[model samples]
Target: MNFCLPYSATRRVLAAALACAVTLPVAAAFAAQAPAPATLRLDYLHTGNASTEQYAIERVVIEPLPWPGNMARTVDDTDRGVNKVEVVDKASGKLLYSRGFSTVFNEWRSTAEAEKVNRGFEESVRFPKPDHAVTVRILKRDENNAFTLAWSTELDPDAPDVVRKQEPSALRPIPIRVSGPSPDKVDLLILGDGYTAGEMKKFEATARRMADQLFSVSPFRERAGDFNVWALAAPTPESGVSRPSTGVHHASRLGTRYDIFGSERYVLATDNRALRELAQNAPYEFIEIIVNNDTYGGGGIFGQFSTAAANSDWAKYLFIHEFGHHFAGLADEYYTSPAVYQPSGARVEPWEPNATALRDPANVKWKKFVAAGTALPTPWPKAEFEAYSRDIQQQRVALRKAQRPESEMSALFKRELAHEEELFSRAPNRHAVGAFEGANYEATGYYRPQLQCMMFDRSEQFCTVCQDAISTIIDLYSRPAPH
Candidate 1:
């Protein structure tokens, strides 16, 4: 049986270094004289649609925890995400920090509803509280896939109106793996929802099990010590989250539920404020919400959060696959599923690491990893795979229409995966790392790094290019300051 440590449980890993120390030699002196900077978070509303968009400032707050990221690595050079946030010094206009991220709003804009009605989503971005005032600029990609300023605001962390006090923390975080200070590691927080007070043990157990599963996978497996895993969840009144498709509705701790955007398997929390309020209590750079239901559903947003049904049969696969999106800005490589997004007629380059528009075959984004003689437009058994997938999808729709048991859905997925593995195993260039067509919810034009990957399917490992991409982010967070 799994159990959560009580609030009295002492933290197992203490901070080995301070947040302000940019290098090793200065760490001791800095630690002795300077206090770690507080965390400043900017809350705003993103309202828009497919063609037009607007942003509005909601508020600013100082979180309970100090900044969790490395001071030396303040700028994100990894060309990823649909949007980027840049914080600059107000006086000299020097860029202080920046990171790329995707939003629920961006995903919603791709769907059919965006053509008619406008929607709004609350968002927040955090940085180390600066000593002086700073200007925050949010950049969005234009039609040509270049970033342009969407919104900009001047922020004063010491302003009288900035929210500095928070409700007393009702829940404490459990340290699953604490390698070192949060500033020196990728601080990942696993939040549990739909877990009742009596099932707190289950949440803790699942969190620990998932952490082990994550570390057992490649890249993560090889660099386990570069991470610090923390678990936090508040007790819910029910044992499972809301599933409106089945006429079920139970309020969960983090407002997480299935059937996002009317897709049965899509799970995510729409309440960013609720999520951030609880997450701010813990030191976290990434979040993966573990829903306590036994449903086959999950969702992820780049640099924001990921979700997985913790008790699902395919929990391990869902855990790692969704994390790929949240952790490394990896695009989904599979295209067979009926996603909510509408198809695009024009080919625009995606900013994700794995998937590409392949508009210029000669100058592929991942050309460095491509081997000689490997075709730019790599061929695969597309017709057969799609045919098989269509049939399976039909059966899947039928099963769901009948309101079948979760076990039935799980079994069907197993058979589907088995079929795919069998087909790919016999194909030519099955293991090649060339661009394979059919990705990012499209059947053509877009490409993936390899024939098989966790992003592509329910495989247990990331592709070589994916491994490198993940390593780059890990380096951004975990690499120590210059000697």
Candidate 2:
């Protein structure tokens, strides 16, 4: 007290002590915070009909967030926006949770453009944690009103069974094969097309019937419990029962065109924006386009969109068969059918599972299925083959005569059901010659593997080759439900 320090020294000592105390607390706080959990990434690949749109997810992973008691799972749809996701507990076989989200972009014509849009969308998604076992689905939109599911998850990380990415060249290309709700639980979304509010109910019924037929088949029957069907309804004004047309025309490939629907040319070629917008709401494995018309026309390109001419007598069968092509990469077996191909390339090995020019028979995709006694270059019966060919020539002549612009003959052909029926009946052996009236290829040189199949004709039966292909696709999607 007698020798007290100066005021400046006293102030300096107090300041140093205060600084030390502050630093210690700050260090403790930093130590208490934990680092973010690692992320689990998932990618989606789609395989459907060729006539429909197709897409794939390139970059994105689903990571789990740490949460107790399986109450809720957090998902990070990395970089790509999360359109929709559904969570199902495999053990419980019950839907635990589901959510639908939206995005700014509507559609992209090219995959590159889609990826860019997805990248921007992905930046906006934030997750609370990164370590959880839950299934997530992602979709991207495109033209033809098509959307592709890019990813999914297996709910229990501890379970040995899980979904895997398929090789690009794998023979079967579809994501899921079962027809009913899955035991392991699944989330499905049915992409929509030109249908109105009234048509939506019919569309759903049609889809349900198609799904039921699909599971009733062999491989699907085996694995019926591990699947689900969800509809993502996308409707348009052009998606109704009928439309104005300039009468049906006969082409050597895709026989008879009814140019009445304004949607035909534009729907398949343009409409990507609408597709993407619809995809932003649900988790789906496949995107099915339900056209509003009831005409007997449908098209499917492998790993692409599957479409059915709506409201027809054969809608259910047509749906399943076309879906086989879109989902399973199955090849058309009837080669003599009318088609859109120009036939320019050298007679090389075809990419389809059923057709081949025998460019290299030794390594055919379906070589295993070829019967031992089956002859290579199977001989066509001369009498029946010639009769069918003659009928085609006559039909061509009739079609040309009726095609005169603005003539009564054209009008007569357009309204004459009897004439059309008579013409179709002439080619009773068309199936035998493998020359169907409405396929996409020339009649003589090409031959489809099966004599009677839905792909070959509107016949209800699917050939063994097609059935096998469907089975393989189902296996790829999930393990078949127990018998």
Candidate 3:
């Protein structure tokens, strides 16, 4: 919603470009007949260091579009993320809505920078509009991996401080794929960044291509008809997003950029306010931003959004790999790549469905998928794999250091993937669903469900365990609420 903020120039330009906002035809259909509740958003500032955190309400917004999620699946039963948000009736204490999500702030806290200084991040949680007052609570996992209340605040949707209306957005969403009404299907908003007005057609085409690639993968392939994809972009003057590591910079609309936390390949959009403003114009439950660049970079946060380099040689892999993190909170299974997160002193079982600590191998979370006599700590060509991985990492660093052509980097990765595939093919447990050491950024102590997975490398298909995790989320959005 529009507020008298300090950015008057931005507001003026946006208002001029977006004269009127229109809702999607499918959204309109639900509104005219079996209307869902109005969407309510609670915006806040999450601040802290690695040890301590604080949250303060910034504002409450009534988004223009109705709730795009299924009314029956309001509570998130899949405990995947680092944090959880719960909205409850203030009077009766009945839980009205809940969803598990992770934020850029959470990831930042894990970086070495958090040990030295404090930081703050803007975050928002949306749910069906409530009729009365409600209590909002944020929960974080404790040492035992159980959720404990971290922050709580009372909210009144009808309060005078709430913002209800805004200047219409000039941008409208292009329907890439409309299988059914939004209430009966997953609504995915494909937002584009670093594309100029002249490249609008290119942006739409890229979005369509990526959406098609996503469905071509398993789980999504089987549930293609259960999704509705929409594409939207507010053009920028430039053709590529910021890459500060290479001395490149551009004032993109969504702040999508590379070199986050000093990791050259880590891409993310840090402007929550701008992102929400543009996204509010569409009906969506999920978002994936495709930056108009060929660099190999992208990032994803659960229940937030994902991004990819639309023109990269591995755009299809980047799209689905990052979506696994954003969609199902799947943990990265590979540990060879350079990352920004600080290593933990102890190994606690990860909340992600794909990775585990294997402290109690007998009761492993995915034990159902394990064969009768599969070893608890599945063995692979660990020594050979790690040795080759080290050499590849050195070459990767040298390529970046010398500023080699992206083609060279792509070719190097291709060779590396081929070597891995060949090595794994000879392993005895190649097709087994056993815990393989090396996952969640650690080579030891942590384990993954399978040796080869899209989350692990530049592979095409998700591992068996990952496919099941994804299907659970798909069913949550497409099926009617469990009665």
Candidate 4:
């Protein structure tokens, strides 16, 4: 296994090394003029109930790695999230960095609990290190979906209170797929949760397998070369994550578990500190935590992280479907599945690319993609589909209440998809790109693009609109935006 490099390659490397050595003084002079940019993270607390919200600065830190994003594409104009972060020069008022991202707290606020009690969440936003002091502003969309400043804070990188150093960690990331330099590629960190020391190999294998499945789908398949996949995991003492409903508990490294917000199928990592500490050890812009569990559960937050049950029967679907939310801010297109989030009386047009309010069908958000003859609020066996889905939902509830085997749940999903396939295959607008009612966990009001999609069901392939949305994010992370 001790293979040496080819003679010519070795000579070229040595020559390059010698060249660096000879230009040390010149290099040092240039470095002094313009040092490489570090990654600066602003950690904060987002606290409030459903109606009122507040933001408080916690601390600022220099992440372990340099920012792994294209400096050329610092401004995010895609307008996708419920909130947007803007970093600007304080004195000159020059916008330097900006990005739109949603939060777990935003999702929580939609739930019934937010009506009575207030809660806080630890959140962080990262940007390229600025040379001098800068102003960081958090903007939220008003009722009309316009960005309005919610909170603003001044930050000085040289401030003595800023955390400039971190203790070295034993956690190292394994390179799953290195396409090119970190700056040019979208760094996707596949984090493993609830894995023991003995399951390290399994974690890597699952990460690779899921990564392969990711690239097998459209958009990601075509843009596979634009991504670099990195796998990282801190070992746990137990074999699986906690399932509070099932009375199963394990001290996982990432604090990932099911039963989030009282939904047994929902999974998320609550320990943002532990997650950030481990994730900083690797170069990553997006993260997908692959939890070692078979039960059907996953969750995603835009600009944050996503989790998938790596051992589930529908792992591929879970990974990509949840990623659709975490990566591109795609709304949940399926409504048959019950959710904890309560619906608002108002259905303002969603900022997400996939979901729309269809306030005006002729001026639909994705109207350009709509084909001729395709009706707005397109018709698609709605009554029949809802009736069938309701029956299947009751079966689903029975299975879960009976504490049925995981295989039984998987089998039920397979049956449901099969039924949907048969039902939609004959519909006139089955494959059309038009507004389809019944999305965003509501039977009406909200509409999704196309009749069927991975977001809409367990089926494969993102709808045309979803594919475009995902591509926009990939470009935002990996390439410069159009001038």
- Residue-level lDDT for 424 in candidate 1: 95
Prediction 1 TM-score vs. true: 0.92
Candidate 3 segments whose C-alpha is farther than 4 A from its true place: 1-20, 23-33, 480-483
Best by lDDT: 3
Model 2 over residues 16-132: C-alpha lDDT tens digits?
Answer: 332232222111211222332322333333333223333354334332211111112332222111144445555554554433333222222123334333322111121222234
**What order do you get sorting by lDDT, best first?**
3, 4, 1, 2
Candidate 3 global TM-score? 0.94
| Per-residue lDDT over 402-453 for candidate 3, one digit per residue giving the tens place of the 0 to 100 score | 9999999999999999999999999999989999999999999999999899
RMSD of every candidate to native, in Å, equals: 5.3, 19.4, 5.6, 5.6
Q: Candidate 3: which pairs clash?
A: 18-170
Span of 10 residues, lowest total lDDT, candidate 1? 6-15
Top TM-score: which candidate number?
Answer: 3
TM-score for predicted model 2 compared with the true structure: 0.50
Q: At residue 260, give the lDDT of candidate 4.
A: 95
Where model 4 places Cα greater than 4 Å from the true spot, the runs are: 1-35, 480-483
Q: What value of lDDT does candidate 2 attain over all alpha carbons?
A: 0.42
TM-scores, each model vs. reference: 0.92, 0.50, 0.94, 0.92
